[model samples]
Target: MTSATRPQLEPRISSFRQNGMRTDALVLSEPGGKFKYKKITLRDNLLEPDECLVRIKATGICHTDLNFASKDRGQPENFPCVLGHEGAGTVIKVGSWVEDIAVGDEVIVTFTSCAQCRNCETGFPGYCDRWFKYNLGFSRFDGTQTIEDPKSKKPLKGHFFGQSSFAREIIVCETALVVIPAPTPAYELLAPLACGVMTGAGAMLNIVKPQPHQSVCVLGVGSVGLSAIMALKTLARPPRRIIALDILSSRLELAKKYGATHGINTTYQKDLMPTLMEITKGAGVDATIDCVGLPKVVEQIVHGTARRGRIVAVGVGLLTNAVSINTFEAVQAGLVYQGSLQGDSDPKRFLPWLLKMNQQGKFPYDELITTYHVEEVAEAIKDIKEGRTVKAVLLWDTH
Candidate 1:
């Protein structure tokens, strides 16, 4: 119930291998609370026929992790759960049925999906039919928790997004694993590509697919927005102008460095729509991406898009918040507004492409990372919330 009560639930083993191969993890015992590092004993014979065990080298601290931990984006029942998804690691063990991946393979663990679903079969696993249940349900498909308290024998919800890599190790389904070649970039740098980076870059490259000479604007120039800017720069015929908007001047400057042609500090602007229109010369941008997901931000982007333009909402905001839109104006302008998840990426195909881009210095997403040891996760979260870091990755001492 409180941080003071954490000691009672302290793991009996100090090291993961001490008691049947349990591992260290930052567990949230209460809703809207701080993460307390504790050891957790995973289920015996943990590998399901379709699952594999991974020794996490690093994991990115995504806003979604913080949102779920803070009870801002998910149900409170998920409390006392291991919350993390952007993970990269080495396959330490594999299920008997895994054919494509083997032990010792380097992989990025992403959101899970039922391969047989209509959306997944159609190549859009981000919109998988069991998406909510698999990724956010805090349990396996058959309703089993992966870790439990040793003393009380109570289930501590695990499998958040199919692999709760906030721990030193995790058990993940084969479908959620994206194998990459060895001798690649450092795990800490590549960890974010599993989620935030993919979501931003994938949205622009895969969904928006901006035409040459078209104008585009990205709101909330954080990790996702900046990734969008970097990805846009690689276009064979890049957009005529790439606009970056944020309340922070520092992020706006980073946006410019990354490739944004114009930067707008929303803090200084009385009305974003007017400034956006002025920048696009009253024609409005061809594509406007709302990466902040605030209702007000969504409404403002709707007002700033040109006729036949597309407005992509990538940010995850409160479910109860609603944005008001003028139906007549939207119909008259022929504007299209849609939402994207994980950039609508098929990670198996997209991660490798992104890795190649990064290797060529075209993506340069590594420049955005600021690393922290697993124990310093709280500090990393603070830096992110205060806009001091574009991306924070937690490096694990799994060796």
Candidate 2:
């Protein structure tokens, strides 16, 4: 039946929920394809009791988003995807089961998780058992698609991190929401906090927890590494030294603004251990974070830290790359090697805290962000890939 002849959708939200509204999206028709702005359908399904309609005000480009949009790992779920996870917007409609949140509320959209998982129940949704299925599944957790291509009417993937907010508007899982309080923060500024900022800050505040006299080294001066520096520096009694290392001299200099006491341009520095030892006064770094995830960088950081120091890995490299840890050296040195996801954060608690800190001027992040119109997503992606922009935030033209 034609939409002109069908019964009128009841509520304003139903018009979008039932009949599949035409909306703006940066669509990737196939894995490794270029993202082009096009019209897409919002899908013709009723919103579940736990869902809500959101108009994306701002969304940040993440490495994960780009990686998935540009690669095909031979997964059946690959291709025809919309990929933006760090989303911030205003709620336009609510589901029957949702009570705490309401229309007109400003919100930050984050990843989804099954409430039944042990991790979820214990406040670590980042490690949820269904995390991959619900967040990275492209489709809904049940393998259903909420978005369709207008012409082909073929199902295109949405719900990347439960929001697929590369589009102008989206319907998201209630579990993925974190409401912003009155005196609301800027949506564009808060967007990256949904993931990258949270991941980096959480690693320091939650995992690293560097001591006042200890030394912390960050092996990448991207958004994540900078956030880690800012976070540890914001501590009441911060570590004695925070080292920032990156191939780009620009990024290494930018890290100094955040809190890094020493900046190392890895491209020019042939050996890091000598510099690390000199900076630590021969004690070596007490903690090291590998945000680059390259084998060489990881190995260098692993060997540069002092005995019994913590070595944390947060970067995502090639799927085929195996992180070969030298078991004997690790055991002999009493070093700890660990992998962290989303900075081991529970978004419900962590995001809000980050916001409060931001408001207090202790965790300033504006310096790292660069904004663009949603239509200029291509430019934003390119700038981030080339290291010209630390964080690319896309602003939707809602009108």
Worst 10 residues of 2 by lDDT: 8-17
- Report lDDT per candidate: 0.85, 0.83
Quote the lDDT for 362 in model 1: 90
Q: Candidate 1 lDDT, tens digit per residue, 99-143?
A: 789889999999998776688877899999889878877888777
lDDT of 1 at 334: 97
Per-residue error at 125 for model 2, in Å? Answer: 0.9
- The stretch of ten residues in a row with the least summed lDDT in candidate 1 is 1-10
| C-alpha RMSD by candidate, in order | 7.3, 6.0
Put down candidate 2 lDDT per residue, 1-399, tens digits, no spaces.
Answer: 221233322323212335677888888877777889999988635566678888899999988887777654424366677888999999988877777789999999988876666888888889989888888777676667778887887778788888999988898887899998888877888799889999999888889999998999998879999999889757899998999999998998888888889999888887788889898998889898888778776777777889899988888777665567788988988999888999999888998888888778888876789989998888888899899999999999633
> Which segments of model 1 are wrong by more than 4 Å?
1-20
lDDT of 1 at 36: 78
